[model samples]
Target: MTMCPQCGSTFLQPLRCEAKGSDVLLVELRCSECQTWTKAPHTRADMKELDRQQAEFRATIVDGYERSVAESMEALATCFGHALELDLVTADDFRPRTASA
Candidate 1:
């Protein structure tokens, strides 16, 4: 609920958030910037802000993962092209497997 007193950072990650009552929540947060831990009783508004921050972080992570996957696929395609040019990939590579009796 409060900024990190150690570093004045607002980037705090919730380690524990439990509903204390209908509108109050017991929150334990760890600061990302200075790794300081703090606990307090928070309101629903604080929980909403925390959820919003987490959603933004989730979106950022998903976007990064998508970009990484796309780059890896492109690299694999280029490698396949090089292999084809060098004749390292033959017709047999595409042939179906035959089972032994």
Candidate 2:
């Protein structure tokens, strides 16, 4: 994570935006010690940038399924082709698991 150029404090709250489609955003960060507020950008060249800022700040996990998209090109295409046929049923047709008790 990049440090704040203003306060020289390492405790920075980084944020992100997706609307720009290139650079994610760090809206505002209040320094823990100096109380300085700074703005930063955490970008992703792949995903579409988000316009509205969200406080939920959920982290995106790039699992084996995701990594293959970038690091391995052929594997991603193969997975996508196979996944298209996977069955997706609604709640009415769903089956619940039995209790072990």
Candidate 3:
């Protein structure tokens, strides 16, 4: 019987198994009360696969962030150009407004 480290509960539920490349099974257990997670023994292939998945997820997030920044920059440039063409250029226009003002 496994006990929860935080709450000392004896009810530890088996969540799932993360298996990779055969001969690699990691059993995850969660405490019913505190929601603390514990992992069983894992092989080298399991660790490698987990690392690879993490790297891929991080790369995807970065790609999305870069795309959003590029789109925002393009929009800002377009707005600035339009403002310039309309002769609405003013030093005060670029200044940030304060909540008090």
Candidate 4:
């Protein structure tokens, strides 16, 4: 049981927890009597699992971003191909702009 740091009340209610590795937990607690929030430390397992999960999440995000970028490039290429087929814009018009020194 956790006690409220402010009022010394034993009415601490757990709000949420953030796991840092497997050994430490950042537990958010709310005191029912004082209505204040406090962070408490709790024990857990080692950090290997936590690290793995974080890496997996990061990889998933990167993969999604790369896929989106590839799709956008493909769409642009298709549009350019259609424009060229219809003679809407000539390939010579796609020259790189030179910056004025």
Tens digits of per-residue lDDT, candidate 1, 9-32, equal 778888988998999998888999
RMSD over all Cα atoms, model 2: 13.6
Candidate 4 has a TM-score of: 0.49
The C-alpha stretches of model 3 lying farther than 4 A from their native spots are: 1-38, 94-101
In terms of lDDT, the best-performing candidate is 1
Which 10 consecutive positions of candidate 1 have the poorest summed lDDT?
Answer: 1-10
- Model 2 poorest 10 in a row by lDDT: 46-55
* lDDT tens readout by residue for model 4, 1-101: 34577998755666788986667888787888989998766665323343454577679989999999999999999999998889899656978988999
What tens-digit string does per-residue lDDT give for candidate 2 at 13-85? 5343334334554355566667777655555532122221222222233355576677678876677667655
Every candidate's lDDT: 0.88, 0.50, 0.75, 0.74
Candidate that would win on TM-score: 1
**Model 4 residue 49 lDDT?**
44
Of the candidates numbered 1 and 4, which has the greater lDDT value? 1
> Candidate 4: lDDT of 66?
100
Ranking by lDDT: 1, 3, 4, 2
List pairs with backbone clashes in candidate 4: 22-44, 22-45, 22-46
Candidates sorted by TM-score, best first:
1, 3, 4, 2
